[model samples]
Each structure stands twice: as C-alpha cells, then as structure tokens.
Target: MSDVFDYIVVGGGSGGAVMAGRLSEDAGTRVCLLEAGGRGDHPLVRTPMGTVALLRTRLHNWGFETVPQAGLNGRRGYQPRGKGLGGSSAINAMIYVRGHRSDYDGWAAMGATGWSWDEVLPYFKLSEHNERLQGPLHGQGGPLWVADSRTGNPLHQRFMQAAQQAGFALNDDFNGERMEGLGAYQLTQKNGERWSAARAYLLPHIGRRPNLQVHTGAQVLRVLFEARRAVGVELLQGGHRRQLRARREVLLCAGALQTPQLLMLSGIGPQAELARLGLPVLQHLPGVGRNLHDHPDFVFAYELPTLDAVGFTLGGGLRMAREAWHYLRQRRGMLTSNFAECGGFVSSRPGLVAPDLQLHFLVALMEDHGRRLHRAHGVSCHVCLLRPHSRGTLTLRSADPLAAPLIDPAFLSDPRDLDDLVAGFKLTRRLMQAPAMAAGVRREVFTAGIETDEQIRAVLRARTDTVYHPVGTCRMGRDDGAVVDPHLRVRGVHGLRVVDASVMPAVVSGNTNAPTIMIAEKAVDLILGRSRAHGASMPAPVGAGADVPA
Candidate 1:
C-alpha cells in the first residue's frame, strides 16, 4: 500500500497477472502491478468473438508491425499486441496447448539443471481446470479454465474427415500424451466467453486483497538499479513521473517484444546498441533482444455455397439475430464458436521428434488478415511451419519508453524454413481436395486454382504471415549470449526476473498463451520454494556461466 512493495510486476499481461495473483496470496507480501495500457473495459474485449473489434482498437492494443523482411521480399509483418489488462490473451484465439514434454526436458539438458518435462508438467496441470474429464494430466481445481469447443462449424468436422481420409490418425486431444494428430482443440474459455488470465486470476482476487495494487495506464520507463541490483521501477503515472520501490524484486512481464526493450532502456543490452540510444550501459548482455522466433502460416481457401446452417457466413446479420436469440434465451448457437474453428497437428517431414506443422481450419475466407471481404462465398485452411527455424531481434530505437522498438521477425529467412513451409502447403492442399472436403464445397478461390508448385510458392511468398506466437527474445541459457538464467532471472542483474514469453529458451511448437501462463505458474512455485506435485520439475542452482534452462 506504500511506495515500496515486496514485489513490483511490470505489465499486467498473461504472465504478470498470474504472478501477481499467486505471489500476493500471502498476507505479509505486498504486490504492485503496473500496466501500460488502460483497463480492458472495451465491450469488444469481453465479447466471445471480440478480437475482430479489438484488432483495430488501438486504444486497447499496441498493433505493432515488423520491419520490411528481406526473406518476404521486403514486406512488413503485422503484430497485434494487447494494450489492456489481459494483454494479448484477451485478444488471442484462445487455444490451449502445453507444448511437448521434451521442450522442458531439453531445457534441463541445456544446463538449466532442474527443469525437465516431469518437473514442469505438474505446474501445467496445476494451472488448468479442464471442463471435461479430469485425470493425471489434468487438474480440476485450477484457476484457469480449459474448456472444450462448445460449438463447431460443419467445415470443422469435414476438415477432420479429410485428415482421416488423407491417412493422418484422428486425435481429439493435442495436449494429451500424443500431440501428433488431428482433432478438435481445447480453448481457454468458459461457456462462450473468453476466460483470460486477468479475468480468471487477477480480477477475482483484486477486490479482497489488501496487499495487491494494480495500476493501469502506467508505463514503466526503466527499472531502478542500485549497485547492479534492481530495487524499484520508474514509471509515468497520470502524466507525472512516479518512482515505486520494490523491496524484494522487480519482475518484467512485458511480453517478448517489449521486455528486452525496457531492459535496454534501463541500460542492459548490447553495448553498441545502448550507446546508440544514448543510454549508460549497466551490462553488456548482447542477447537481450535476440533469438526471436514465431510460427508463420500460409492459408488455402475454397469457395463454399454458404447455405449450410452449421457452417460459417451463416452467422451474418440475419443469422446473427437468430443466434443472438438462442444465446440470450438459452446460450447456444454460432456465438459460442472461436471462428478459426478446428485444426490438427501434422509432421512436415519424417524423423522429427514431434509434429512440425500446425493447421488451423477457418470458415471465413479472407485472403489477408484484417482485409476486405472475400469476393465470393468461401472457407480456408491455414497451415504453416509450427516452429520456424528463422530467428530475429527487437532492439531499442530510442531511449524514450514511448518510442516503439525496432522489430525484425525475418520471416522465412532461412531457406530450410521455406522448404518446410512449401511441404506444409502441399500437404494441406491434398487435404482440401480430398473426398471429405470435396463433399459440399463448390470450388477453390484463394489457392484452389493453383495447380503447380511454382504457383503455390507464389501465394506463400506474397501472403505467408505469423500465427501471432513469438518467443525467445530473452532466452534462458547457460551460454553468455542468453539474457536470463534457468530460473527466469536476468543475467548480470540481480533481483530482476523476466516472467513472460521473453524468457522462453525456444519457441513452443504451438500457440504461446498456454506456455506463457505455465511459465508464470511455475515461476510462482519457484519463488515460494514449492514445486507442483505433478508436472513441475524444479532444478537446483547451476553455475552462472554453465548451461541453464529457462
């Protein structure tokens, strides 16, 4: 309640909200959470399909875009970051995935001594409350809700049928023991409303917790350090600069893009880059904004008659009125759908550890993101490199916190990554033209007309874009190039922790919201000296210069 608190968390996004909620549980500990954006009060943000309305809502979103990527023939990649209480989780498609077990095990093997699949699984299980069956892999009483798809488009069922006919086994659970098949995806929703991190964790506790203070519309300018120790945070509050002290630690949950930018603003990054920003270098950690990765997808669409009651486009105006009646009267209809409906996981090539490509089936057939209406009735199949090989960086463009950081996703930068993408496109095409999809589909619109590899490559070169999953900016590692240690603590900086997607050592093979939440959940256990009884494996301290898992 005072100027100084036990913990000062920066950014009230997916991870920060979880940390603030969990760590503030102790009556003796005081927590302060600062969010740059306004409260998530926008009506669109709360609606089940509010992302469309929120996409162009700049007041509630950062809406950053990447620099012209040479790999994409000098095209700028669009980025939609949530600028509200829930952060991107509020605007995301709401898919829930824990990534592969080997993802964490590899962290342990990389010098992050205690992190393994076995250790992290408990934390994952502990954070989720699956609406359906509860088992060893799932926990029932968790704060976060993982609900099954309440409604499915007819096209979704057909996509599965096509996958089944194409020889890939059908899998109803991508987060189960096996993640290498096609099936319906579980979303982070309850009924038809999105249960974002802020809504599930922070909101319920804010009213009753006296020790926790959440400050919205507060932009952190820098982390205050004394003798290389993070002691507090300096922020702009209500047009007035206010300095808030943190007695124990300053946690950075500013997401992947902005966390490193904040650190650099406080003089913790490449010496040359810092010097260019006119900042006094506190530490020369070159990896502060490096190792950025994401999943880039290329979409395929086919024209449909738009007559089926169970398919998309049927939810427009007249149908919307009918659906509104159903939802208002009984809470049923297309209003419950996430729209990017059902999808599956598949391997782009053989000999890989897990599925390398993820497919998203959508009934809407717009060729580009946030674009004009489709010329005709249609649906689309989006498939791309699940875990791309290309890497990029985000660097400070100016010393001012208001200045946007320079983002370079470098999509399809690697020739190998492009090759994998081409393979993925080929496979998706096979599924679309198969008997299952052909049953009621009239004709192909987007790529249905393309027959050769050259034509398909042209489509990808012009339109392949990100699936909105970005990670690895502040990678955890034993190497000097890594920005953070295995426990998500920043290297060369004491009492400062990076608690978001930024600390991911590598990009998970799917949507990032779930893993980001898992990171925060596991970090809470570590801070409390507790480990999840099931999936969270905590490691002992490793040498600073040795390998570490984050």
Candidate 2:
C-alpha cells in the first residue's frame, strides 16, 4: 500500500465509493478511500428487512441526534448516519429515486454552472443499471443495480390503490416523464439483496485493482493543509495517529453532516466560531455549515388486524421464520421488503409546478423512525415537505473530532413550512382514509380524530422530524456565501473538493441517494477534465424547460 495517492477520498460513503472506483479506472492513477466504520458485510446489511435492526442498533450507524428543536416542541431529533464502506446507502431504505428534473435545472439556475437537467441526466444514466425500466431516462449496463421491490405483500398495491381512490393518479414510474402520483418504488437491490454503493462500485474491483486502497475503521481527524492548499489528511487508525498524503487532490465525500463538521474542525469555518473554540482559523468560510436543511416529516400510523403488516406476535414470528427460510432458498419473501415499499409524489394544492410533498407508505407501524415499535400489526404513511423554506446550521459543540456537532435544522422555523405541512397532512390522511385503505384499517392509532387545522399543526409540531435527506450545508454556487464553487472546489482552498450531498445548494424534491451518486458520476468528469461529448449523453426529457426559482 502506498502512503500517497493521486486522489485521497475521505469517508467511503456514497460519493467516496464512486470517487475511488471511477478515479482508479485509470490504471495510471492511484486512489485511497477512508471509512470510519467496519467493512459493512454483515448479513443484516444485505437483508432489506434488516433496516429495522440497523437503525435500532449502533452496528453500522453513526446514530447522531440533533439539538432540541424549537419547532418540534423542544424534542431532540434522531439522525442515524451510516458508518462503513457504503455509508448511508448501506443503511438506507434502498429506494432509487433521482428527484425531479427541475431539481438539477434549479441548481444551474442558482449559479451551479453545468448542472442543469440535460447536463446531469447523463450521469444518472451512467450510474444506474435499471432492471425493469429502460430507454433514455435509465441505463442498462451500469454499476448501480436498480430493480423493482420483490416484496409480495399485497399491502403495497393497496396503498397505491388507496392513493388513486383518493383522486390521485397511478404513476407506474416516478422517474419517468412525470414524478406525480402513486406507485411502487424502485430499490437499489439485486436478487432481493441490498445493493449499496460500495457493493456497486468498490467491492467488485477491490483486489482486481491494486492501485485502489480501501481502509476501514480509519477515522479522519482533519484535513492537513499547507497554507491554504489541502495536502493530506490526519487520521486515527488501529489506536495510532497517522497521516496520508494526496498527490493530486483530497476529496471530502463525508455526506452533509460530517463534511461541514470536518471543515469546521479543520479551521475552515466561521472565524468567530473557530476563535471561540480556541482553534486557529485556516480559512474563514461561514457557509461551511450555514445552509443545513432536511425534509421535515410526519407519519400517520394505524393498527390493523392483518398478517400483511410486519409485527412481533406469535403468528407474525412464525411467519417471519418461514419467510426467512424461504428467503434463504428463493431469495424472496417478506424479508425482501424495504418496509416503505410503496410511495409517491403529489401536490397539496393545484397549480403547483411539481409535487410539494412526498409520501412513503410503510407496511408496518413506524413511529420515531421505527425506534419505538408497536406490538401489533399495523401500517404507517409518511408525509414530508419536499422543498422546505426554513434553513438551519451545523456548528461544533467542542473541538473534539469525536464529539457530535450541534445540528439545528430549525424545522418549521418559517411559517410557510408549517402551512405546507398542514396541507400535506390533510392530504395524507385522506389517502389513508380512502375506501381501499379503510377496508384494511381496524382503527387509526396516531393523530386520530385530528380534524381541525390547529390540531393538525399541533400534531406536526409534536411529531415532525427528518426523513433522512439532509443536504445543503456546504452549499455550491457562484455566491459569496457558497462554501464550494460550481466545480465543488472549496472557495479559499486549492487541491480540495467536496463531492457529496453537502454541496447541494438546495435539497432535491425526492430521495437523495441516487442524486448523490449522480453528483459523483459527473464529478468524475470534472476531476478528470473529460468532456461531456466523451461520456454518455442523452436528449433532455421532452417538455423539460429552463430552470425556475426554487
């Protein structure tokens, strides 16, 4: 193993895995990937139903919690970040969504040059190997494998039918011409097993490419800088402090929360904050942690007397045991369920350009991110405001790199966000109460009998938290407040770049995993200075227009 490489990628998460894999494709270049967690090869990580165990336990999760949120009546929010080779992708629901076309176009409009829908669609196609869908919108032979969920639970179809019964259209493909309506989600899986970013990009090529080095349980303390240029990284591995140099560049792909925390810890944050923490300032970038935001979500749960929902009763336990055996033999059954198997995008009101709220109809009674479980068979539907108006900040609680950062998403700080969520709640309740869904429902369990707008607002304040899509901390744009520029390079530094979800100027309208992977795919070209003409290019979706203000 070499101490120095052409590219040193920090945090072997979604983007870092892609970076290491793509950069090392050039046999001439050497790449090193650092991960804070273990190899993430546990059977729990490969099983879709294992998501519950992963989130509940600290095995592969960072298990971060936010400061008490004023918007949620001073309740601390739970944030479970993935720790290991694949990062959050290894622990996520496996839903493969690329957000709406407007999301990328809006980025270009906001001065993130060369990131329009037409410009970025190629990267999305390049990263995906969709088994069911094909054509210009999807790729066939790609690293990331995406397939329809293999869960045979009839409740998934019932949720879709219920949405349609409530006057919503049934959309077969949310990633197609339209992102509006109800349907089953395409998952990042192959043969009923979870297919994470590491699985797609790094694992297959590990020993085959000697130039690519992946080190797990290597925690990066800070980026080492010579004056204003990032030269290497200081990390702790095997109870020993060590340093690794980057011959060309040091890429930070540590996702939203940790990326900003890393920058601040390395003295590249607000001058006052750094000085107060008794840390010398390397470069003052206030936006390193200023634009923090996530989709504030509320879940409506109901108890049902049916075996279709996952539970812990005697019958349910026996059924799960049988399903486990079935999964071992056929690789399909209840164990193949990604709990939130079916969902959709829809608007709370008419005349909206795109859906303002996204729904995840789960086949279990989920509350507090499934942390607090119910002993009965039930179902849950999550409604989240897609594009929130409120913004928050991430600051260091202490100079200690191991200390959790001060996460304040300030959810619903803007009055309009609350209003939008109220509308979304009413719409979700209507779908849950529709004839198709009502037939399976024994009774409403959470937020039941809440009809008034004020009551709904109260419920939101009490229950709303993150739906796991956190971005925009290290914003990318051509503005004074932007932390990274259009090319994802740090504003006041050289030989350094952030190629992850943190660089998003605004949160996308859907799941962020696929979009983050796309960012890495496009970043490979930028880092290598390759032209779009040489990469996979496709015509823009018909009727897709210029960017609009988000």
Candidate 3:
C-alpha cells in the first residue's frame, strides 16, 4: 500500500466506512481506512444473539467505563463501543432508527445549516434498503438493509399489546411518517443475519476497488499536521509505529467518546487544559470535549415463567440448543432475536412537542448492560430520557494515547431530567401492569413496592445509566463553542473533518446508529462538493416537526 492517499478515514465504524466506501467510488482518488480492531465479521458479530455476549466482553467491544457518576449513587457507567471494521454497528442491537424529524430541524435551528429534516431526509433514504416498507420515506436497493426481525417470539407482540392496553397508540413504522407509538423495531439485517456498515459499504468493495485500502488493528496515535492543515495520521500497528498521509483530507469518525479524545491528543482543544497536560495547542476550541450528554436510562426488570422467553434454566438451555439448530437450518428462531425486540416512544407529560422518553422491551433480564446475569426467566424494559438537559465532558486521563478518556456524562445533573425519568418509571410500570403483560409477570426485580414519586426518584438515582447513545462532545454548529462547522470541518484546521455522532449538536430522540449512518451519507456529498445535487429534493416529511400520534 502507498504511504499517501487522497483521503484517510480514521475508525472503520458506521461513518468512516461510508466515507471511505463513497470516496473510493471515484477511481482516480485513493482512500485509506484505519481501524484499531480486527475484521468485524466474526461469528459472534454475525449472529443476532451475539450482542448479549459482545456487551460483556472486549472481543469486538471497547468496554469503556465512565468516571464515577454522582447521579447513579456514584457508580461508574458502562459504555460498550464497537471495535473492528463495522464499529458499534457490529455489536449493537441492530435497531434502525433515524430519530425524530425535529432532531434534524433542531440541528438546523442551532446553526447547522443545510441539516434540517427536509434537507437531510434524502440521505436517510439513500442509505436504506428496506425489505418490508416502501414509500417516499424509505429507499430500496441501498447498501444497508433494513428489515423486520425474524424472531417469531410472541413475547414481543405481547409487549406491544400491553402498551396498547395501557392506552398508547401502535406505530407500525418508527422511521416512517411518525415516531411516537409502541411497536416492533426494524433492524439492520440481511436475511436474518447482521448487516453492519462494513457489510453494507466497505466489505464487498475491499478488494474490488484498487484505490481503497482498509487496515485493521491500526491504532492511530494522533493526526499529523503541517502548520494548521491535517496532512495525515500517526498510527500504531503490530507494535510498530507508522505514518500515512492524506493528500486531500483526513476524516475522524472515531465516535463521540474517542473522537474528542483524539482531537485533544492532536492539540486541538481547550488551550488551558491542553497546556496543562504539556501538549501544544494548535486550536483553542473549548467545545472539543464539552457538551457531552447521553440518554439516561433505567431498566425495569421482572422474573417470569420460563416460557418462550430466554433464561438460564435447564429447560431454557435445552430450548437454546434446539434454537441453535433451528437458526443454523432456517435462520429463524429465538437465536435471531435482538433481545430488545419491542419498544416505542411516548411523552412523559401532556405539553411536550415530541416523545421525550423512548422504551426498549427485552425478552430476558438485563442489568448493567448485560454484564449482570440472573438464573431465572425474565423480561426487561428500558425507559430513557430522549434529550437530556444536563451535559458533561470527555477529557484526557493522561498524555498516553492508549489510556481511556475520563468520560463524565454527569447524568441527571439537571433535576428536570431526573423528574422526567421518574415520570417514565411510573409510565412504564403502568404498561407492565397491563393485563396483556401482567398475567406473565412473576415478580418485579427492581421496583417491587415503589409507589410514590419520591420512591421512584430514589430508585432512579440508584439505577440510572446510559442506553449507549452518548453524543455532542465535538458539537457541530456555527458558534465558537462548536467543534466543527456545519460542513463538518474542524473550526480552525484545514483538510480535516469529523463525520460521526460526535458532531451532532444534540442527542437525537432515538437510537443513534441510523442517524450516524445518515450523517456519513450526507458528509460524502459535502466532501465531493456534490452536496447541492445529491438527494437534495424529496417530498416533505408528513407533519414534519409535529407531535407524534397520541
């Protein structure tokens, strides 16, 4: 491989894969992608049930932990980011959600020009190939496949039924016209197997494109610069140090947590902090590690009879053996379950403009991001505040590039966020108590006798953590506090950009994977100067920015 290229994309996750894949489409330009982990096509990543194992292990995951959070009674929160080529998409739940339309509109409102719902809707459609749904909203024949879950488990249906019985509306498509009701989620899958960003964009074109070179296990130490322009990157591979140059640009898609850390390590951050660490400051952008926030989530777990749901009992073990065979033959069964099979969006109060709380219903008991295990059959539901008012920061632990960043989400620091979570607990408890789901209930594992608001608040303070949607460390906007511009370019640097969830001005109202993919799709156009022409026009979203169906 050559030492120089037209573009160098760091991190082969959702955004980096798309950037490299799209940039290499022009045969004249050379593109290189660097990933810190191995090829993400492991059997554990391909199987849908592999996510449960992936959460607790570092095999394909960067099992990162936060600095002790005062919100959760001073417990460190778990953050599992995907390693390898597919990034988090390889290890995530595979739920395909584009957040609310207002999320994009809100971005534009925050000075991220050309990022309104209508402006960015075309990119969302451009990256999707939905097998079931078709319309102006969904796309066909795209690289990323979006389809319904193959799990025929009735528990998912029962959860939705219980939601309906609790007086919530049924939303067939969360990514369609509206995103505010109880229903099953569409996944990023192909014929019941995991279809990650690597599979969709980078994998098939690896050897096919002579200009595209992908390197795994390449840990980038820092961005190489000439004066102010980002020229290349210094990386560590096989215990050897090397430098690769980018003739056109260097893109950072290392995700929210690591992206900011990289920026700081590269001498582009708060000047005082950078100088305090004995690192030279190239740009004094205070927003490099500021505005860090995430979905503060609390799970309500229940122990139920070992029926169709998965458990650790002898019968469940025997059933899982049968399921393995069933999955091997037909690619359909309990093994195909994403665990978070059912969920929806709802408002905690009457006056909210959009659904403020999102839910993820699981068929098995989960605690601490599946790190804690139980021996009984169970069900779990997660309720997370969609947009948190409280913010935190991501800072360097030391000058060492390999050291993990000190991540402080400062969850629930804003009392209103805690208030909303308390309301969500009450609301979720109601759904669990409904006749459809109530009959199967054995015992509430977490909140058994929690009744009053004060009790709910206390439980929330003890158990609240992240739903794995951390964002906004490298915020995108036109203000000085913004780390990147509306075009995703670094504020004071040339030939550099950030094209990942880190650039989101605020966390969206749903799972972040799909939106991260959409960001890359649009960023490709921006890099090619074809932004004005590529998918720039489409029918306006139905009731754009309006409240979802009640």
Candidate 4:
C-alpha cells in the first residue's frame, strides 16, 4: 500500500465506498479506503435475500446493543451494523427512498447550510440511476443502480389493497411528486441480486487505479493528531497495530456508533465525560455523541389461514422448507423473497402536508428480531413513526479502544414520539382492517388484541425497535462544540473529517443510506475545491433541527 495519498477514507461502507470511487475519479488525486472487516467476496451478500446470511454473521456485521431504553419498558434495543466493505448497506432490506422534500427544506431552515431540497437534489441525482425519474429533481446517469425489486409477491398486492382500503392513495412513487401514500418500494438493486456499494463503487475502481489502495480488516483505533489537527490514524492490521498518515486528509466513515466511539477514544468529546473516562481532552466537542437519534419501529402482525410463499414467519417453516427446496432447484419461490416485499408511506392523520409516518407491508409475520418475537401463523404490516419527536444519544461507556460504547438512543424518550406512534398504530390498524385485505389478510394477532390507548402504549413500549437507521452522532455544523464543520472538517482539528451518517445534524425522514451517500459525494466536492452550492438557493437547518445536520 502507498504510504501516503491525496485523501484517506476510513470505513468501506456505503458512503466510504462511494467517496473513494468518486474522489478517485479524476486520477489527479490518490485515495486509500480502510475497512475494519474483510473483502466483499461473500456469495451470500450478492443475493437479495442474502441479508439473512449476513445479518448475524460477524463476517459482515457488528452486532451492537443499546443500554436499556427508559421509554420502552426498560428494554435494551439491538443494534446491527455492517462490519465489512459495504457496511450496513450490504445487510439492509435494500429499500430505496430519498425521503421528503420538506426533510431537506427543514435542514435548510436549520443551520445546516446548503442542505435544502433544491441544493440536495443534484447530489441525490448524482448518486441515483433512476428508472423513472426523468427530470431536474433526479438524474439518470449515476453509478448506484436504482430500480424496483424484480420479484413481486401477490401478498404485497393484497397489502397495498388494504392500504388503499384505509383511504391512502396508491402512490406509484414516493421519491416523486409527493411522499404521502402507499406503494411498492424502489430498491437499490441491479439485475436480480443485491447491488452493494462495494460491488457497485469500490470493486470497479480497486485494481484499475494504482494510486487508490484498499486495506480490509484494518480496525482504526484512533485519530492521530498534533495540537488538535488530525494528521493520521492508529490502526490494528494483520494482528499488529500501526499508524498510517494521510498527507492531505483523514476521513472517518466508520458510521454513527463507531465514529463517536473513535472520537471519544481519541480524546475528543464532552469534557466531563472525558474526565470520567480519565482521558485527556484533545477537543471539547460536546456533540460527539450528543443528539443521538433513531427511528423506533413497531410491527403489527396477523395470522392468515393461507400460508405465503415468501414472508418471514416462524410458523411458516414447513412452507418455507418447500420454498427453500424450490429455490435450491430453480432459484424460485418464497425463499427468494425479501420479507419486506411491499410497503407504504402516509400521514397518520388527515391534512398533514407530507407523511408523518412510514409503513412497510409484509406477507409474513415477524416477531422481534431484537429478542426474538414468538413465531405465529400470520402476516405483519410494519409501521415506523419515522418523523419522531424524541432524541437520544451515544456515549463512551469506557475508554477501552476495543470495547463497545454505551449507546442509548433513549428510544421514545419524548412523549410526542409516543403520541405520533400511537396515531400511526391506529392508522396501521385501520389499514389492516381494510376491505382490500379482508379475504387474504387476517386478524391482528400480535398485540394481544388490546384496545385501550394505555394498553397500546404498553405494547409499543414492549415491541418498538430500531429500523436500523442511526445518525447524527458526529454532527457537522458551525456550532462551537460541533465535531465537524459544514465542509466535514473536524472541529479543532485539521486534515481530519468524519464523513459518515454520524455527521448528519439530524436523521432524514426516510432511510439514511441515500442521504449518507449524498453527503460523501458532496464532501468529495468540497475536498476537490468544487462548488457544492451549499448556502446557495437554500435555507439553513432549524431548531436543534438537531436532525441530519450534515
């Protein structure tokens, strides 16, 4: 590997992969990407349904956990992060939603400069190769492949019918026009398999560019700095630890959780917290782990008389067994389906401008993957109160570099979050009871048939978990204690930047993968001295709009 490069990107996840590929495009600059996990050589990751193979596997995932949530009946939530090349994008459900325009507008209203809808459209368009969007809002010439899932299940149709029965218009596209109805999800897939960032962005440029180097299984321990300016990284590679320099810049794309952990480990975080950890304060960045937030998701399930060909269910084992046999023989049947085949988005109440909540329709029933929900005969329509009102956080439990940090996304810490979720549950229940699904869909089998709001709240507290999208740990802004600047430069430190989801001042209303990629693309432009058009024709971010601030 080259001793120095024009830029060093850490973490070969979704954003990191894209950044490395995009930044190395000109060939005028050399770039090296480092990942804590191994190469993207696994066969399971290539399949759409192969997420199950990588979900719990250490080969491509870091199974982290949060401290007990005070709002969720004191239950701890399970956090799953991608450990390999593509990061969580390699293990995600692959749903591709760009989120709402207001989400961007809200960012502009906040202090996050140039992140308004108008300003962000180019970046989204740049990362997207859309099949339908043929306009100014979206572009077709991009590396990331965006298309509908090839395989469609009839159960999904029935679910959509149910959603319509609940009075939601059949939205053909959530990423287009308005994002306030139920529809089939567009995925980040090409051909028939999962199109991971590593496959789409990294691997294509790995061997062709000699200046670009990729080092996998290289765990970064901390950022090396001199008088607060980050100059290099200390890493553990091949069983031995070493320090590597970045002649120009060191980028952190290690994601929300690890990015904060690394920052705190490197002595950059809240002063009091660092004092407790007995670490010297390299930088008194209070926001290193503050404003930690995530969407707390809940699943409502049903038991159907007829079994599905490809829904995730424990009781459907016999049918899945037959389906698995068929898949092995001809690559067909239920085994080939991703459990979340169809879904919808809508406002929980009437008269809302955009969708306040997002729902995912499913043919199979899913219990808690966090602590394992009991398998029963049914289907589930998962609904997440995406535009949550609550915010929690991530902080270092100990200073040990090898130890996992204490993450408490104080799930539903705010009462408003509960109210919104309750409204969503009522809407979801209405959808489930719709005439469209009356024949195929069954009764609500999961919630113990509870009726009262208090009971519903109790159930939600017990069942609500993360949809796995976490951001805003290492927030970017012009604030005094912010970890990174608007250009993604680390505060109080030069030659270093955190370029992952953690930099989002706030979480986007939709899934975070796309926004994270957009951040990387925009960050590259900033590093290359190109105009990002930030603060141009856009408003600033809002009140602790303290959301995907980056």
Q: Tell me each candidate's RMSD, in Å, in order.
A: 2.7, 4.3, 5.1, 4.1
Instruction: Output candidate 3 Cα RMSD.
Output: 5.1
- Write the residue-wise lDDT of candidate 1 on 472-533 in tens digits: 89988778888888777888877888999988877878889988888899888766655655
1 against 4, candidate with superior TM-score:
1
Query: lDDT of candidate 3?
Result: 0.91
| lDDT at position 20, candidate 3 | 91
Q: What TM-score does structure 2 among the candidates reach? A: 0.96
Which has the higher TM-score value, candidate number 2 or candidate number 4? 2
The candidate 3 region of ten consecutive residues with least summed lDDT is 541-550
* TM-score to true structure, per model: 0.94, 0.96, 0.96, 0.92
How far in Å is the alpha carbon of 292 misplaced in model 3? Answer: 0.5
Backbone clashes under 3 angstroms, per model: 18, 0, 0, 25
TM-score of 3: 0.96
The worst-scoring run of ten residues by lDDT in candidate 4 lies at: 541-550
Q: Which ranges of candidate 3 are over 4 A from the true structure?
A: 531-550
lDDT of candidate 3 over 1-550, digit per residue (tens): 5799999999999999999988899999999999999999999899999999998999899999999998888999999999999999999999999999899999999988889999888889889999999999998888999999899998877888898899999998998888889999999999879999999999999999999999999999999999888999999999999999999899999999999999999999999999989999888899999999999999999998955878988989999999999999999998888999999999999987789999999999998888889889999999999989999999999989999999999999999899889889989999999999988688899999999888999999999998999999988887889998877888877888899999999999999999999999988887665653263443332232221111
